[model samples]
Target: MLVVSLIAFVMFRFIGDPVDQMVGLETTLEERAKLREQLGLNEPLPIQFWHFVSKAAQGNLGISYQFKQPVAKLIGERLPATLELSFVSALIALLAGIPMGVYTALRRESILSKLFLTISLIGISLPTFLIGILLIFIFAVILQWLPSFGRGQVVDLGWWSTGFLTVSGLKALILPSITLGLFQMTLIMRLVRSEMLEVLRTDYIKFARARGLKNRVVNFGHALKNTLVPVITITGLQLGSIIAFAIITETVFQWPGMGLLFLQAVQDVDIPIMSAYLLMIAFLFVAINLIVDMLYVVVDPRIRIGGGEA
Candidate 1:
């Protein structure tokens, strides 16, 4: 988080003067100087960074230069949208990818399996923005089946708001979720198929088959179980990537998520927002990785045994 914060600070600090964005052209030199002093932009880089770090540690992310609101407040307002989109995308990827992978692995010679592979290849090859645009063209423009952009309708519940309870909100999520998830789904599918094939060739799988185990039991209970260790790792990392990289999809869809907020900050040179976003994303990556590490023990007994021995 410190490294990310420093990088964000250095990178954004020099992009433009925050005072220039904060103040109008008619502002005098004395006013600009006072504003700089108030914002601490006149301080040395090290001192500024120290103040940033210290305040961040105390749960104060500072106020946004552009929005003139608290950084934490801005993020808190937008976080739910991003998390909702990311989790829905991740769920779509895992739900579709894993079954497709298993089927392709088990029915490699079938024409249907070949078709799925072809579709997976297309999913992997398409860029996210292009995919989103295509979906919009098909579903929104041509078919008039779904809305092209916006969150549609959001229901506020105290401090948090959500779209899931509303029908239009659920409809609004479909395109962006699919666009964001397609690449990840293809990746997970390919990984699972490859791992399943490898696992099937192992001695344990052959032993289970030789023991007259049913095909479903041997394939799913044994082969699929063993393939999941790598799958879990990739899925966990991809979930983090979904959140971090949702910027493109959010921009394309105008989804009002943190990514969209970050883009606005970049354009406006809102250093506080940019810095807070960097630190938040870094913290999320760390937290997701820690959870993934814990999940390894739950998914794979070998990891637990190795840890016990060491």
Candidate 2:
């Protein structure tokens, strides 16, 4: 994470001063120099980066060049929306994927199974933005069933709300959640199908079948339970990816999340916010991976016994 943060910070040096972006062409070099000095741009790159790192340790991500507010504060305000979106999307993926996967895994050679798998393939193949646009066209523009953009009105949920929960808010959330979850849903379906197929062929599954256990018991009880360990591993990693990679979906839906903030920062050449976002994203990935690694021990004690955590 530190290495990635350092890289993110260093990349800005190559982009030149963001003050160049903010100042007018009529501005003199002397004026630019003064502005740079005011923004502490005259300092050595390493020194500036160290200062950023130091402030970041204290949850200060510096000031946004565009918003003119502290970057951390801005991110804090936007984060709950992103979290809500990611959480809802992952829930959709899991609920939709697992059952479909188990059902199809138990009947892989059927026509309906083939059709379902084909759709999952297409789901995995399409770009997320394209999916979002298609959804908007179908549900928002043509059908006029759901709103096309934004996070909608906030419902007061006391301590549990991001201020984005209401009848209108729930209505607006549908398309973006489906758009974000489709890829994960398809991926999870395939993983579950593959794992289930392999598990069904195992000796325990064969013995269960031979023992005259019901199909439901053998599939749901024995095979599904065994398949879950690997599926969980993928789900954990994919959930992390979903949170970090929601940037494109947020932009398509115009959702007021970190991704939208990053887009705005990019358009305005807001290097401080951009750099902070980059670092924050990398840190989340690292933190999620660590948590998932620890979960391996809890999920399957054999890993712990084998010293797999190192």
Instruction: Return the top candidate by lDDT.
Output: 1
TM-score of each: 0.96, 0.90
Per-candidate clashes, comma-separated: 0, 0
Candidate 2 lDDT score at position 266:
86
Residues 198-280, model 1: lDDT tens digits: 99999999999999999999999999999999999899899989999999999999999999999999888888898899999
Q: Which candidate leads the pack in TM-score?
A: 1
- Candidate 2 clash pair list: none
Whole-model Cα lDDT of every candidate shown, in order: 0.92, 0.87
Clashing pairs in 1: none
Worst 10 residues of 2 by lDDT: 156-165
Residue 12 in candidate 1, Cα distance off native in Å = 3.9
Model 1 residue 222 CA deviation (Å) reads 1.0
